[model samples]
Target: MKRKHPELYEILVKTYQQDISESFKVDFKALMGKLKERVGRNSPCPCASGKKFKKCCLRK
Candidate 1:
């Protein structure tokens, strides 16, 4: 979806961030940091696309 529709993907991501922040009172940056710690840049992406995180979703 992201590759085919980058603008829509960004909008959805922003909306999701807002929803998470409002509903859980969570800090999105901090949450992303924790997630980044768990996934090495050279490791396979959590999205299961068989590509390294840095070359895949991390590009976003």
Candidate 2:
């Protein structure tokens, strides 16, 4: 799939990294700030499940 869709592959990979990395101890305010900067509430979810942001990651 990645070879067929490099752009999408990149998005999926980035999203995966974001999810896993969030589990580690990190700055609170800075992380939220970065999330807001990078992920809009209505944007496609970072989970690679084709769901909207508000319906996915936000629910967690």
Candidate 3:
């Protein structure tokens, strides 16, 4: 089917890829937010930096 309709196949592939990427971005952000909430402001940064969460990546 795809070989018989290369243009349609390409369009479908591009649309599906875009939709998957957008969904992943949303899920990743939500996951990060949950993880961030689990870490305390005064806790050491997850990156192993001696700095506190509030002073490190949290500031970003």
- Predicted candidate 2 versus true structure: per-residue lDDT over 1-60, tens digit per residue: 989999999998888777565476455345445564577889886666698878866645
Best by lDDT: 1
Clashing pairs in 3: none
**RMSD of each candidate?**
14.1, 13.4, 6.2
Local accuracy of candidate 1 as per-residue lDDT tens digits, 1-60: 999999999999988777454565545345456674577799887666698888876755
Worst window of 10 by summed lDDT in candidate 1: 24-33
lDDT of 3 at 47: 60
* Candidate 2 lowest-lDDT run of ten: 25-34
lDDT of each: 0.72, 0.70, 0.70
Clashing pairs in 1: none
- How far is 5's C-alpha from truth in model 2 (Å)? 44
Off by over 4 Å in 2: 1-37
lDDT, candidate 3, at 29: 43
Q: Against the true structure, what is each candidate's TM-score?
A: 0.37, 0.37, 0.38
Which sections of candidate 3 miss by over 4 Å?
1-37
